[model samples]
Structures are given as structure tokens and as C-alpha cells.
Target: MQYGFLYQFFFYLFGVIGVASAITFVTRKNPVAAALWLVNTMFCLAALYIMMDAQFVGAVQVLVYAGAIMVVFLFVVMLLNLGQPSAAADIKGTGARIAAGVAGLVLVAELLVLARQKLPPLLPDLPRGTNITVPITEPLFRQYLLPFELTSILLLVAIVGAVVLAKRRG
Candidate 1:
């Protein structure tokens, strides 16, 4: 395939980004910074998914992992006051601010790239008019419905717990 090399290049690029971000996520002492790194890792994974022609999965990666999940995690972190910067924190106020600014710029750049690039599929002649989400949705809504609902309920419980904990502390 003519695009095989291009595909491979992006795969490795995003793969490296994902791994690096994951490592950064683990190493950061600041919860917010760690969460930002995790978000970056999610974006890289989404890019990799799109590269592999799983556009639906990629969109879900962005929308669910990067968007909804991160918001929830950040909400929990904030509620727990885990993002408060102390003098003893690995990144002090100035350093944390700098890191956040850089992360924001990088996020904007990555989103722009995602919006601008139109990638050719690795396989040239996939059948047209086939809805990509059908296979995924069928099992997800039918077989996994209970688990899905349970996960949502669990998240709701977690949010309520966090709120209770925060209220008690304050």
C-alpha cells in the first residue's frame, strides 16, 4: 500500500507520545498535571485509533476518555483539594503555572492537527456505506447494557461520596 509508510510513521509517532504522556502522568506529583498528562495520552491513543481506520473508536476516545472522563477526574481531584499547590509540591506555583500553559498550547496544537489532517485509509478499498458503529453498538447496548448502567451508577456514587467528603473537611 502506498500509505503504508505514512501510516506506520504516524502510528509510531502517536505511540511514542502516548507512552511518554503515560509516564509523565505517573511521575507528576500534582494531581492536575498528572490528569493533564493522562488527557494527552488519551489524545494520542485516539490519533492512533484514527490512523488504524477505527474512526468511531477514535472519536469515542476523544469524547469519552479525553472529554467526559477527564472532566469527572478533575472534578474529583478539585473536590478533594488534591490540586492545591504547596511549597513542598514537586512543582511549585510558578513551575506548575508554566507547565499548565505549555500543556494548553500543546492541546490546542494537537486539536488543530486533528481537525486539519485527512488521512487516507491503510486499506484502499474498504466497502462504502457500511456504518462503523453498528458492530460496536450492538454488543455495547445489548450484551453489555447492565455493565454500562452499573458504571454510570458507580460514577454517580463516587461523585456523591466525594462531595460528602469535601463537605465534611470544609
Candidate 2:
């Protein structure tokens, strides 16, 4: 009841922050600044995942996306010397400004719609002293093991590709 309400409130709070941060990330002209804003967005998303009771996913979101991936992005930005400040001539014209305003209004309307909705319960109540990790791990290892290993392999390939590209550019 009360707990659920609090959870919903925080969920919306984090959701809004995540949306705003994502907008900031894309709007920034400086690549480093944009990457930092993206990291903020990732953190907000991780908070949302935790609020939804997916603790393992949330932790991975922060550790993998915000930590590891962000470091890689920042490193690449530095390696490419992309830290130079954006030119002042990049300002938007009147039509672009109006479009941004309309997009903002759309976001507000969506938020209002979310406010009126109640999320269905995620799980039946767990018994006292139940370990949360057990539920998450059992299914991940037994049912989803192949996909998990494939994802790891994919990530490794991406990292190797990045290294090769960087070397070519250097």
C-alpha cells in the first residue's frame, strides 16, 4: 500500500531524470560532456531497474554500462581528441526551438498518463528471509545459460573490434 506508493513515486522520479539526462546527452555538442550525461542516464535507468525489484539487472546496469562502457567511451573520446569545446554557431533556429518545446510537452503528457496508472504486482510475497539472488540465478543459469554466454562472446568481439579500429585510426 504505502510502500507501493513510495516505490511508484521514486520510479517516476528516476524515470524523469533518466529521460532528461538522455535528452541532455544527445543535445550536447562536446562528445565528452555528452558521454558523461549518458552515464547519468545509465545510473537513472539502473535506479529504475532496482525499483522494479530486478536488483541483479540494476547492479549490472551500473557496473557494466555506467562503469565499464562509460570508461571505454571516455577513453575513445580522449584518444580521438574530441574534448574540444563546441562552436557557438551551433545554436538552433526558431523552428528547432519550437520542435523542442513540443517534444517537452509530449513528455509531460506521458508523465501524467503514467501517474494515473498503477503497476501490477511483480511477484507474490516472498517468505521471510528468502534470498533474492536465488530466484534470479537459478533461471539465469539453468534456462538462459546459452544466451548469457553468447552475450559475453558478443561483448568480447565488440571490445576487440574497438581496439582494432583505434589502432587503424592511430
Candidate 3:
């Protein structure tokens, strides 16, 4: 029927898939399976971005996160020959699990408080045909240039480090 209705439907569906994928990513014993789950999660997020009308962000999410980042993850998994299932003994203990659960609850509470305080009310009707490209891009390149470059460099370094760690020592 309406575009907004379709968008909302897909949004909820993808959101559920994203959460499921994230859980699978964490719980899967196989490295490849975890990476695959992560990739699925990224794709769902990209779909959500598209539903929000952030075309540039959606494309970047798919291209950079789902495509490039997942490729790197898969490469590392393959290079390390992480084919075997993780040993059952490597799982965390009950005390660590309790601590992690408590930490997660605290984080959720903090996020809820922050969201309640900072989020503006959604406008009933956003201005039609509004263009945000220049507004968004100009500041990203001009004001945040250094931080952006640094982030890219940091990611590159992480990739290199992963490669080095996975390589066989001569």
C-alpha cells in the first residue's frame, strides 16, 4: 500500500533479523559461521539505513561494512584456518556470565536514560523534497576530516595486525 507502511514493515523485520544475527555471531562455535552471521547482521543494518532514507549511509553500510569489512573478516578466518569448532572448555564461567549480564543491564539502563533526555520529538511531517546531501557531506569532510582520516588509518592498522597475527612464523 503506502511507502511508509512498507518501510515500517521491513524495518521491523530487518531489525529482528539483525538482532538474531548478532546473537548467532556471538554464540556460534565456528569462526566462519560467526563471520557469516556478522555479515547478515550488517546487511540488515544497511537495509534499515535505506528504509530511513539515508541513501549514502545505506550504500556505505553495504559496500564498506557488509562487503569490505566482512571480506576482511572472512580472509582472517580463512588465513588462520579456523575451521574446527571451538573447544567447549573455552567457554566463560558462570561468574563471568553473571558479570556480563549485569554490565549489559547497566548499559541498557544508561542508554534508555540518555535516549529519553536527548532525543527530539519526531516531526509529524518532514519538509517534502528536502535535500540533505550538501548539509551532511560538507561538515563530514570539512569539520570532521582529521578524525575521519584517523579512523581509516586505525582500521587499516587493525587489518594489518590481524594479518600479521594469522601468518605462520618462519
Candidate 4:
């Protein structure tokens, strides 16, 4: 389907905002601030996903990642008293800084290569009026059922562990 200028405009707008928010997330010194920025980035990504015709995935992204995961992260941060100045250490020293710079350069190179790829659209080439979630939910529940259950169990374990650790330390 032929898209108009507005489609492209919103796509690029969300894309740029996503990238900028992700950078802000990384550069933040406070873990809570960083997580909030990360949530903003996730929202931008969800918008992009919706724009690309993946409504279910976008909704899941917002609900699961931004809502659930970030809430867990912030809860853990608060439980562990991470608001203290000494809770995190800066990446000091010339060697560590140089290593970080090299890693950043490698990431930039990978992104450049990814940008050159002519990838297909995420959704299938079905009629625009078709229900998209039916195709996705089938395999997600059938083929990937085990992994999905395992992921939930893992998250439960993580939460329990965090609580146990916090209680012990307190």
C-alpha cells in the first residue's frame, strides 16, 4: 500500500524520539530516572510498532515492558535503597573509558550495517482489513507455550529473590 507523507513523518518522528530517549536512559546517573527514560523509549517504540501495523505487539510492549517490567525495576530499586549517592559507581579510569568508547563504536558500526538491510515489513502481506492478532496468538500460545510459562515462572522467582535479598539486608 502506498503511504502518504504523514505516515513517513510520524515514523521518523517516533524513530528519532525513541533513539534520543534511549540515549538519555543510558546517560542518566539515577537508576530510577534511567528506568523512566527507558519507559519513554519503550512507549516510542510501541508507537512505531503500531504505525507499522503491529497493534497487538505494540500494546503488549507498553503493557508488559513499560508497565510491568519498569514497575518491578523501580520497586526493586526502592527496596534496595538505590537512591543513595554511593549506590552506583561512575565508569572511571582511562582503561574502562577507552573500552566503553570502543564498545560504543562497535555498536554504531552494527547499527550502520543494520540500516543498510532491505528488510521486509514485519506483518504479512494480508489485506489491510484482516485481523493481525489471530496469526500471532496462535503460535504464541501453541508453539511457544512452554517458554512463555517458563518466563512467567522466572519473573516470579526474580521477584522473590529480590524480596529475600532486601529483607536479609534490611
Task: Give one clash count per candidate, in the order shown.
Answer: 0, 0, 0, 0
lDDT of 1 at 26: 74
Tell me the tens digit of each residue's lDDT in model 3 across 1-170. Answer: 34587677888999999999999898888888888899999999988886776767888889998888889878867877876786665568999999999999999999989887956665453356766476568888999999999999999999899789968899
lDDT of 2 by residue, 13-101 (tens): 99999999998988888888999999999999999887766777889999999999899889988887879866675668999989989
- Which stretches of candidate 4 lie above 4 Å from their native place? 84-89, 115-129, 152-156, 159-164
How do all models score by TM-score?
0.60, 0.71, 0.75, 0.77
TM-score of structure candidate 3:
0.75
What lDDT does model 3 reach? 0.84
lDDT of 4 by residue, 1-170 (tens): 57799999999999999999999988888888999999999999999988877799999999999999899899889978986545547547899889999999999999999999998866555576889898788998999999999999998998899778767552
lDDT of each: 0.87, 0.87, 0.84, 0.88
lDDT of 2 at 140: 86
Model 1 local distance difference test score? 0.87
lDDT string, candidate 1, 7-111, tens digits: 888889999999999988977888899999999999999999877768899999899999998999999888778786555746457888899889989999999
Candidate number with greatest TM-score: 4
Candidate 4, position 147, lDDT? 95
Error of 3 at 28 (Å): 0.7
Candidate achieving higher lDDT, 2 or 4? 4
